[model samples]
Target: MKQKRDGGVAVTGTADKQPNAQLTSWFVRSGWSKGELARQVNRRARQLGAHHVSTDTSRVRRWLDGEQPREPIPRILSELFSERFGCVVPVEDLGLRSAQQPPSGGDIDLPWAGPQTVQLINEFSRSDLMLGRRGFLGASLALSAGPALLEPMQRWLVPTAAAPRPAAAQGPGAGGGRAARLSEQELQLLESTAAMFREWDSQCGGGLRRKAVVGQLHEVTDLLQEPHPEPVARRLYRVTADLAALAGWMSYDVGLQPIAQKYLVLALHAAKEAGDRPLGAFVLSSMSRQMIHLERPDDALELIHLAQYGSRDSAGAATQSMLYALEARAYANMGQVNKCHRAVRMAEDTFCDVRAGEEPAWIDFFTEAELHAENAHSYRDLAYVAGRSPTYASLAQPEMLQAVEGFRRDDVHQRAYALNLVGMGTVQLLMRDPAQAAHYTDQAMAVAKRVRSERVNTRIRKTTHAAVRDFGDVPEVIALAERLSEELPEVAEPA
Candidate 1:
């Protein structure tokens, strides 16, 4: 309704008249979908000291139908568009009334605000560099005991200390050194490098080229000490956080548990510095993943709960789906079949609601393949705990079969592909399909031999042992066991 009122000017009417073309044009230019635009509105509402504004896609649809929303929305949309488009988007732009003062956001109550983590990251990375240079952490050490890990989790959940100033400039890479003169090209290079590292880790597993990744991380950590333009600084921290998280995953993949913890802590700190809550939540999930791997499902549950609680109000549906799925894995590990089932159903439901453009770039990994892979795991655990009962076994089969096929299609994620093969093969064995089990097991062994991930190797070993112990009477199982022996002769789990 962009009808002009005063002096015969056109403006949008408050009635459901013609489509609100003016409002549509601006947001379309900003490249946000209806769901994403709705999320931004709700988030902006919270920042402006209002409760979640009960805004969603349907509300957005009504606004587009030339129906002006009540007070805060018009005001909120005006400012939100202004920020997004990097131009003054007055109420007249969207034909809305924004003639009120915007509420101020509440002060952050948590401790260690702003760039305080710069100091922490430098110290941790430097120490890592020194120790790693000497091969000190080359061998696995004991993982953080459950009680010892609680302190960090508590700080993340309820920080008490106020913000501390960043460290002095005399530190390495500080006081206008390499990072001080960072150019756009250099920043782009760093971003591309991080992306490349992720792709590499995906294709080849985390065991290969780990040292090169860590070496690059140390150099970039030093660059963090020097200040840069605001935009550059933000991107720097974001890339650094991504690198640290990837490093942690690689460490975990290689079975260096304690080292993985340090990298994860660094990732979490960097994410906080960047003010990227979603990335921070992802880091917490990674930490929970580590805990699950260690068989500490209670700790895993707590860590995932912290992730859920921290991002409950603002995280998109895709992220929530992943968090719920991770929660399901924790439940599965604890053998809480009902709780696991509930969490899995929630994950599946949330996933269905995820719009194409609602998820961020990093969430590109958690698609149908990943979800089905996780479900297969949850049901496999349940079946195991139920003594491989046909009931749960039947439930697991389709998911496992689907996930295996899905991973097979994405050959770039080598470890996932190999690991899911092992899983599907094991489930087949549980169903007493000796020939099918052997077929999948041999294929899994062949693919696993190409990946350098010790974690994958360890799990495949477990599958091998299970086959010998439970399906030994089957002739095909005996054949697959001999094949595994031939392929991984004298192989031992990583220290």
Candidate 2:
């Protein structure tokens, strides 16, 4: 009763009901003989305590014919294939990537280049949900055409045209009353969101929860674009812009450099729309932090200059110190030792100039100990680039110790403190004192266990690995290494 199909293939009741030849091809390409793969899969299933094992080749063939594997089998199949191949075999190669690719422009009736605003919003939502799952890594989240699609989206978010003044500016008092009220509301929202994110960043690592922040930002951006009274809208725009900048920072924290860059550009536009010159400048400084991470010290310096220029009149002493300290870190990374020292001096001078009670709430996080720790970090970074110098060695010990003490206070600030301890442990390892390094690293790991932070754990592991390599035979160091190793999942090795 079957009819002959095109290409000389036999067809079943419907064209859609035909076997998925592509799946079979993938199995062959994966380098496993059909019988061998089936045997391995059965062994893995039995190991997982499956009550009954199907030894039939036909059952396995049906799975290759496009039937989805039952629970735990998919993971088992992945493990077997990966073990045999000696690399990660993505689920996609098993014909199980996603139900479908994102809609094409033609299908959605959107511009070929630019994503429709609505489509972009939906993608943000999807990315957030996908990213929130435990162990979800975005390293494999590649768009079909690479990152070029995001360029247009970034450009659209950052309008190149001259910003128009809000209609309220023409009103009798320039909508002062409404603007004030909106500003208060926006401030509350910003403070609340910032606190929540800061806590999460300390506990779960910015990498884990950052996508949700990005999603929330997209929602805020949509709200900003909606028609509203001018004053209120402008305030919302500014607040949303700051949130967007924070999202960019989180993206950078997780090593998503391209996406982070795009978000920063969009954040600049939003900041400008609200006439918050200082906030815009602060965002630019944050951009410099990403540039530093990317090892583009020259670019970081230029961005810092731009930030300083933009906020020259508006920035207070604390803000000035932060900007200078960040610039010093960049210079340190670049091996410009003298320039790094000079920038650190400038930061200290600026901090000294801040009168008691004159500091802004936004800059309250930068304390004396934090400043010194930053300087120590800059020195450590410089040592890595330029080889250890007497100057770096001298500054490393005292500053790191101070940082550790300050981080001991019970608060969200503990995250940064633990991070500094790990940094110090790295310096100790570099100094060839494995016992000392392990001591600090162990403390950092203890703090990391209490906090749900991926970033902290990542840093702690790096320090621990260095210590282990230097003193693998040292009993204390070996024990600490074993403990930390046991904490990570066997399948998910610590990076």
Candidate 3:
């Protein structure tokens, strides 16, 4: 809750410990000219969900003259300096620190109360849908940057001391009708549309209908502003959270990880407001997946613990199984083979007990196939840690193949199935069978052509890299390499 110093004029009394000196020294050490610093700061601000800023060298000059930039600008400056210097650079160090104030969650806090959550979602949805708002850093820093986003979530870990009391519905504003009784038909329509969106995302990849889902989520937020009976309001919050979470999931699929993180955090807010502890837990679990993909295994582990904490004892077999599966992945990344194996066993055991209707509908994607596929990935990771043992490859190939086949039988998530095909291909290549690896890779490409998933493309790239690096001289590898080179320049001829 640190405040920034006033930007109006130069402050006297400490010229020897000059704020200007600190700014100048750091600015010089950074090797970025004043203009470059301005550009980078503005970019980072946008990523942190700040209003549009076009800071310039003149603004930097003002800082050098002992005047501070207001509020978040100082915070943004600290972030850039810390990232550039590889150390913690507090606002105090930047000479812009002022008296502490109450924490408002620094632009990312989800209001779990009433209409504020709806307003937050509306603003976020609009900003995200507008391509002009995208930062130059893109989505890569979403989870990788770590603490900025995690700090807010860490605060969310503590439950509210008082339970939320429902407020009377507000009368119609200029935009829409007053609070009205929520009809059964309205809820049914939302549920059906969500189901349809899920099907489309699974079949054709998130790119096929991501915008549609986000727009629907914005529409659903309107229902939150309307007054309903306590029960109806609670149900409305739950469904809205579900839609928001879906939007986040699709954003992840299409490689907009920052936007995905934003929506997921908002969804977590809505879920908590609805008293849907299980859904809240799932959102944390989803965030953990994003962290792992960002290569932040330790951060991912923290999110896993938070997820399990939310579920406590009420989580069903399927939910518990999925959580453990994610834990196994986290451990695998950390090279904790024994812990990873134990978690895999836990997931396997719990999934065995999952009854047909035990799982929430949203988690229908976490079937036996996903468990097997993730288990294979965990095992494959152990092999890397243990010096690439052929034994692990032998074990991994069958599990990945089973996953691909399972997805095939369901006739859903073709992108996932294709990605697993690439996994199997990689395992075969590691086991020194170029011909079989080529066969699997070809099959994967055939399926992959129908989907627009960055994740699928990433797997395809890995498979191709293994082929070219290890067995490029082989005729089968050569042919597949040629095909990949023609189709994906980034994968075949990486910079």
Worst lDDT window (10 residues) for model 2? 106-115
- Candidate 3 on 356-465: residue-level lDDT in tens? 97677888888889999999988877677678778877778888888978988878778778878888888888788988899889888878789878777767877887
> Which residue ranges in model 1 land beyond 4 Å of their true spot?
1-116, 119-135, 138-142, 159-179, 492-495
Per residue, candidate 1 scores C-alpha lDDT tens digits across 1-495 of 354232121234544477788898887898889988887766655544456365778767767777656556775676577546433365567866543433221111122544555655565556656665433443222245355564565566554453433333233444443436677899989988987888788778888967667778877777766656556667888887888888889888886655787778777777767767788888889988887776678888888888898888878888999999999989987889899999999999999988997776667678788899888888887787788867777888899888888888885787888888888877887787867877887887888778888777777777777878877888887887787788876453221
In candidate 2, the residue pairs with backbone N, CA or C atoms under 3 Å apart (3 or more residues apart, or in different chains) clash, namely 203-452, 204-452, 205-453
CA lDDT, every prediction?
0.72, 0.63, 0.75
lDDT of 3 at 85: 61
The candidates, ranked best first by lDDT, are 3, 1, 2
TM-score of model 2 vs. true structure? 0.65
Which one is best on lDDT? 3
Q: Provide backbone clash counts, one per model.
A: 6, 3, 1
Candidate 3, superposed: residue stretches over 4 Å from native? 1-111, 132-148, 155-157, 161-178, 488-495
List residue ranges in candidate 2 displaced over 4 A: 1-187, 355-361, 489-495
In angstroms, the error of model 3 at 371 is 0.9
Residue 408, model 2, lDDT = 78
